[model samples]
Target: MATLLFHLGRASFRFRWFVVLLWVAVLGAAGFAASKAPTPADEGFTMPGIESQKAFDLMEERFPGAAADGASARIVFIAPRGEKVTAAGNKAVVERLVHSAADGSQVASAVDPFQAKAVSEDGTTAYATVSFAATADDLTDASKSHLETALDKARDAGLTVEVGGDALATKPSAGGAAEAIGIAIAAVVLLVTFGSLAAAGLPLLTAIIGVGISMTGILALSEAFGLSANTGTLATMLGLACGIDYALFVVSRYREERAKGRDPWEAAGLAAGTAGSAVVFAGLTVVIALAGLWVVGIPMLTKMGLAAAGAVLVGVLICLTLVPALLGFWPNAVLSRGARRNSRRHRRKQLRTENGGSRWAKLVVRHPLPVLLLGVVGLGAMATPVLDLQLGMPGDEAKATSTTERRAYDALAEGFGPGFNGPLSIVVDAKGAADPKAAVATVSKEIAATDGVVSVSPARFNQAGDTAVFSATPSTAPTDTRTQDLVKTIRDERADIESRSGVSYEVTGRTALNIDIAEKVQASLLPYLAVVVGLAIVLLLLVFRSLLVPLKAAFGFLLSVLAALGAVVAVFQQGHGAELLGVESTGPIMSMMPIFLVGIVFGLAMDYEVFLVSRMREAYVHGDAPKQAIVSGFRHSARVVVAAALIMIAVFSGFIGAGESMIKMIGFGLAIAVLFDAFVVRMAIVPAILALLGHKAWSLPRWLDFMLPDIDVEGEKLNRKREVAERVPEPVG
Candidate 1:
């Protein structure tokens, strides 16, 4: 693997312009493809085999073209508290808005508030429903503009008018400010680390190139695979972070080689051989972990994972090939003046004193038990809140306050109940039943009497009179536990309702679909964790050539992940500082967060593990004592690990600036996880535990060791050659 990577680097240098031009051509192709790509709407959450999903399918079949792929807009009109919407002028204004909305190109139909009896009992508020021909995400900007223009008339009439509903809920966010800030911080960190404008810019430039290609690829893939809208944002986030970090690793190594007096081309090749191999392995770990999301069998999550993984893969490839070719283009500029001066100073002094990581390693050697205990205790504290973690999906309420969906949601909640925003569809299969209309009416009446049900609409039978649709509003909010319980209660009555009315009942709608998704995800959580963790263990075992190493890594990383989750739970779920963070309300964590976090965090945590432990193992293999090897390895690898961790934390933390609460939650979770894992687990606990284990940390049974392939990820042979080159004495002049 090392030889292959080295030759690949050498060839890239030999044909540097060709390599650079090839990437430029790829970027051009990606841009052109992106421009022509079809935009796919968000598939949302799905659990295909679940009862709620079955119910949804039944409804779709019975009422084809019934806004199945579209969303309805709510045109809310609120009068002054002292005034009644029933007043002649106020009602007229609302009717005018409704009529205008019905005439809009996007609107399939509109329900006049007066006709639909949608006015609140207090008569201060009324809302009309405007059905659209396409989902909120599928609607073009022109269509939304026309719809908004139509709704603008109500506001022009001196009444408060706002548009809300699925059409507005899934609108694309203008959230690049946070991401831009993240990239800026990353640039600063790189500049500080490299202390040279040219050196620092290389990583940033490479990252942008890679991310650009990956994003365009995602857009193109969405045309066919129907990726969720969030995929592009997430892929960009991971792509930039990983691209810069991977390039940083290789560039740092190249600088180190140059410091040792190797020519630029040779240094680049050697750096690629060593650091490039590690980058490949690290990236593969991340991709494999993300790909594990497919095991959950959720289309949205699966595509998200694939998109992110694909982006990271592009990052890895760019770091290995394009970065080196760029280095070859201007070899002299790769070394900063500060680095050169430091090399001269270091050579003159032949410094003997240990740095912080080495000193910490020595402390661990002296007192392993205490260090290990302290690290574990700290992680345990952070992990405590995870026990109280609740998982459920958020709704439009979680969107940014500036969003039309958020304003509309607030209006609906104030005028009606919170449940008004998420009504459940009760689909009745009255086929072959005597008096199908009466059967549907009986079921509707029973549903209205249910404990959690707020109201039930009159049954609307299909053209065949065999299927009926009844809208039911729950008393609680959409994401509320009681709302989910209401879904359960209604579904539980399926048998009783079926027996009494001779009509089968199924609860179906966005609210019920979300509930079902959560339930299905929760049921599969443990199995998914097992699969990801189990696969990580096997992969780590092969790389490290030790059973204990993989076990410790898997277990410790899981602890770090749990600690991160606990932090999110404390901040978001427990509402400890939610208001300060701009979150509107406390609610359950997103259902898919834990799954996504586990896959992402585990892979990221392993990246540091590979970089740190691989060096330690290299030293141990070269005949250093376990304690000495730990110190030497850490002393060398600590700077890069710290730099990389800081970059990741900055990038992730910046996302917290996003307006959407769910995005903030995910950002906070990832940031916290990286911080804990890198600074706490990898830097402290890992060294202590390995110090305690000594030689056993790398121990494998003789039979198993023989069966496993020997993997030299750090290019030990190249290291040996460099050592020899540095040691050879010049002829006495």
Candidate 2:
């Protein structure tokens, strides 16, 4: 294995240019491909039972230009009290709005006249919609112009207008914007932790490349299989988290090698073999955890599952391959002179502990219960807020991060009856034997009886014989307490109506959608959490050949997540630090956030746990006391872990500004999860526990340790220098 790694290291130096060029070409190709890839905005993937997707697909088929590609744009019009929405107002503002949808100075085509449908029951609430000429996926100059005209006219009209829907929702911001923030944060953190920008940039570059490939590849597939727009952001987070994390593993190894005065490429290869193996294993575990989304039996989850798994796989592969290859090209200057010197200083400083077992191992031998108790108590505090968690399904405006949206929602809620902004739909299908009129009447009476419901509109039959749609107004705005309360009331009452009224109907629209999604998500929450924890444990055990080690890792990861979640729950869920993150108190956690949190948190926690224990295990195998090994491993990997986590936080935190509520929550949850794991859990608690556990951590029975084959981290690095000198080309990154 050592011989192969040595050869691989030598080959990397010999074929440095080939590896570097391969990256440039892959990046170039990805960039070009991404340019052509359509943004999936609002489109979702193949989750079964989400009839909304099917319904929308059918709507698109019926009205080819209206709902085919993306969600039809929702334009909300607001007129001052008692201002008759004049026909002039409708024509000059609403009709004219469809004429100027275009790029700068160039008009494309006006919104198709058939596309504009009047959407108000009375004159007070009015709207004109402009459907895209083609699918949002197939956006063209003509379609752009139509959308622009609609937006411009709405702005030009006397009424306040807001353009929303899935198309605009999926807009990918500057891809580089996320990368830049990630890089900047990574660089500063790397410098602070490892104390070198050059050192930081290598990992940052690797992570960026990985993220690029992930997003492009996922999006490209989205075109074929119909992935969700939300998957785009998810891919970004997973890619960055895994990418930087993998690099940290390699970087720690590289530094460890350099400390021994090894050549740069030699150290890089050593790092790849030593830390890289753990990276591969950890990455696979995360991929496996995310892939469990498939088990949820929902298309939305399935789509997110595939995208997340793909992103993690790409990240892991990049870190293992491209990062090692890229490191071959770094000059000795790659490490700041001080870092090199410190490397030497720290190396000798630890000679007493080198391959001599972890300090944690010794501590565990000295006192096990104290360490265990401390960890449990600390984790208990963090888990406290988790018990108070409430689930909420916030509507469109609740998803907005815009100050304007904020001010508007607030003013609307305060000024108008909350019901005006809370849009809920109750549909009766005659095909299902539901009487449209009777169902509508029953629905209306039920809604009116609901404390928070303020108004129930007369039923509007889209299909005269069987299908009818009716609107309901809650006593509060979409974000208001009353509106959300009404959603719960509607859902709770659904069963009774089904039994008594014999009317089978589905309630949909923004508010009901939120509520239903939240309820359904929570229903399956336990199984998902169990699966994630189980996967992490089983995967780790298979790699380590020790039951205790995997359990410890899982416990550490859970603690890390619960601790971070508690803090955020206190802030966001419990209303402690909501103002700091710029989120309004919604009184409950968002429906999808927890599921998303488990995926992200488990991935990252596994990352640190893997990095830390891999080294500790290595030291234990080399005959060091376990305490000495744990503390030493902690010291060695601590800097890189902290740096990697900080970069993740910086990149994710910027997303809080994206004007999407769910996205911001994801960003915050991830940032907090990483920080907590890197610092308190992995750094302190993990070490303390390991300190208390001694050889029990690495102590598998002779039968298991001897019988279980040791997993090689890096497939033994092959000495391909002789072959590489012949100028063999490298595969694309």
Best candidate according to TM-score: 1
lDDT tens string, model 2, 1-733? 3344445554655687876677678767777776788876664333345433344444344334433333345455555577634455554565555545433223223343224333444444454444443445555555555565566656565666655554344453332465467656666777776556667677777888888877777666667777766676667767776887787677767776776777677677666666767777888888877887766666767777778788788776666566667676664556666555666665456465433234434455466567667766877797799887767655544543453334344444444455566667766553455464676677668766877667677776553345556677776666455665766677678788766666655656666555556666777777887887887787787666678878877777778777777876787666676777666544567877777777777887787778777776766665667776666565566566766777778877766654455656667777787777777677666776666566676667878667666564423223244336447777799
lDDT of each: 0.83, 0.64
Compose the digit string of candidate 1's lDDT tens values, residues 430-454: 9999899899988999999999898
RMSD of each: 2.8, 7.4
What TM-score should be assigned to candidate 2?
0.78
Cα-lDDT of candidate 1: 0.83
